[model samples]
Target: MTTTHQERPLAVLVGVQLPGVDDVEHAADLAELGRLVQTLGFDVIATVSQRRGALAAAAVLGEGKLKELAELTGGSGVVPSGAPERKNKARARRAAESGEDDEDDALGGDDDEGDADGAGSRGARRATVVAVDHDISPSQARNLERATGAQVLDRAGVIIEIFHRHARSREAKLEVEIARLNYVAPRLRETGGGGDRQRGGIGGKGAGESALELDRRKIRDRIAELKQELAAIQREQSTRRALRQGQRRVALVGYTNAGKSSLMRALTGSEVLVADKLFATLDTTVRALHPEVRPRILISDTVGFIKKLPHDLVASFRSTLDEALEASLLLYVADASDPTFRDQLGVTRSVLSEIGASEVPSRLLLNKVDRLSEDERDALRLEFPEATLLSAKIPADVAALRESLIAHFEASMVEAELLLPYAKQSLIGEIYENARVLSEEYGDDGGRLAVRAHPAALDRLRSLLAR
Candidate 1:
């Protein structure tokens, strides 16, 4: 009835409570890190936490705590000097040879477990990975790997891995690749023998570049190529977005696993990928609001944001986040049942601000209220008086949300009269598609119609009528 490390990769979570971070925030961050590790298929076995003014530059944890952490991973409980460079180089070369370097095999290779002396006698069950709650330096990661005898992944690494795995669209895949390459470029190490050199000089007399330098250069070149490809894809996306400029667009932006996808499915009736994992949906999916209201509202589900989302990913996914930036309205969704939903909402706002989406008109939607008790719901209502509290599962709640979306856009609509000529009767579909027809009267020469639509859409309709 129990799972072993062999069945699933075992991970040990590590956290350091720094200055200005209270216990609640620290605990929440560590819990989020555990979810991220689980998202990568790792079963977190234990957590090592420490309170310090700052994270230790060398090992991230104090000496005693470091050793304590090592015991759980069958390590030697000592941070050695740079003597393991040769062994690490060999491991890197083997990983490269097996094509594992380009994959999400950071915690692979069972041979790398156990103590540094190749002694498997440390009876404690070893963890295959150590996931840090905060971002650490490359050197710090290497030192921790040496001290704990496990693959080390900081918070950013875990998030990037999840994005890499969940990316489905070409644009998302390219963006994830760029972010992954940027992450790996700095962590490249010299492989092969310690003194082995690759030829970089014309005559071969001068010392050539190290394997590490070559790898870094390759990563840089690959990242550049990926960016160019991503740019091309983004150009196509821009064109498509431009076409939707006259239509009403409502974007769903929120923290990961905040039930955005569930609400998205309910409101739009689109079969988008819905899951209970971090970064489950990375692709930007645009679906028309179901029951399909006049002046159809295009609802977009963008990639969810998280606390400490990597800057590289933010920059790479800017095109994707443009869905939020350009929306006529934004729905800031959150799980009201979660105790940390407030913090999660703050993070979502911070990221939106970083992407310049803060100026967009938005509504707070506290989802999953079905899980909350009556007292909890009342407390939430008092705290967020203006927010819409509803669960995605309830049909009436979904209908209310859908109507609210329609009403929000309808508030800005202007009434207009269009005369559809008999010769251009085919244009009737266009009018019905772009506006809510209030009335229509057909005559011998043309049909007189009254409609309500956004100003931009009406202008477009007038231009089409003129042509």
Candidate 2:
């Protein structure tokens, strides 16, 4: 018999020391896991991890450690100095039959062959689910599950869960569902490796009525349904894009929660939801800007980016992220207060490039400079010589933004004048709305007028020109 100090709702932070991810990132991943566990109503009282060589696989942890974790997660591991963690004495008795004796007493080591089934092996309420800090290959996930008595998932899966929690709109929900299904589909286990269907938990996991086959079928069907729904949504988005192409679209692109939404609201006076969380703005929001200052240059606020985003997920969200594709100009807003601002900038560019917006002309808008010291602000100006140093939260900076935008738009616009008869008052109205009016006047006969419009808006105003 043995006693184990068992903390309820504990999670094991597993890590595979892979290349391109340093120790700082490994720490960050663990922190993110803590946050997600909290969100899922689980308290992380401990983290168990092992480092292995770069070439080493097989979960990067040994089998003995796995067995130890399995016992604890299975509710047969030790607690305190001499007791089990099961609140239910009946459950504790149930666990004891599963060969949960102390390591010194349990057949000398982890290799002892003990064949015990059904009656007492399961003790933990939440079955052991393995969380890895790295990307897990499909085979890797399957293999990890076999090696450890738990369901396995990687960084992307946890992120998708957070996105699921934050998603609000139909479009956003569909996008998240599509991403989640895509991420999960390849990882779903077909074989009942742990035990059998009757021996597993729900979602075909941990051995219960919601068997592996049932879980696989649900995942596959959901994947099909989400694909169909996303395709339809993509078609609708395409239609809307055609209409918007008539306007010069400037998409505000940046890192997540870098005040892009706040900037959008400030510029267009549109009340978009602004929050402090990552990926707050999932949908692209377009706003009419510079009506009098610049013609046909509508501004859009798009979703933010993070480092090491899942490639398949990015590919799936390409349609929703069309702002980068359709954008005539990208206002790359960066947070001044971020310590890794340069690194984040690189990541943003990489993500944009992956989404096929590499050559798009971008204005580096260094936002939140109000939080910086004067010396720090000077250093930033030197770093980004062409970037507009401003605080999106400040009205003065908003004015500076407006000036920069007007300048950019005017630089792109081709000025042309068209003459219309006074009877074509409707055409004049079109000119006023679609083009920045330079001058308006009547002919000597007062039956005609002359107007100037930006070339970008001329296509949409063509029919009105006929009037």
Best by lDDT: 1
Write the residue-wise lDDT of candidate 1 on 1-467 in tens digits: 99765567678888887668887888889889999999999887777777655666677876767776787787776778753322335544765776652212212123223322232243444788999998898988989998989999999999999999988989999999999999988887766574467656763423676666666777887998999999999999999998888899999999999999999899988898899999999999999999888989999999998999999999999999999999989999999888999989999999999889999999999999999999999998899999999999999999998888888898899998998988888888888888999999998879999999999999988888889
- Once fitted onto the true fold, the runs of candidate 2 whose alpha carbons sit more than 4 angstroms away are 1-12, 19-51, 63-130, 138-152, 190-222, 290-297, 420-429, 440-452, 463-467
Stretches of model 1 off by over 4 angstroms after superposition: 1-6, 82-124, 194-207, 421-427, 441-447
Looking at model 1, residue 388 earns an lDDT score of 99
Q: Tens digits of per-residue lDDT for model 2 on 2-70?
A: 999765454555554444666666555566665555554455434544433341244434445445555
- The clash number for model 2 is 18
- Candidate 2 positional error at 378, Å: 2.2
Spell out the clash pairs found in candidate 1: none
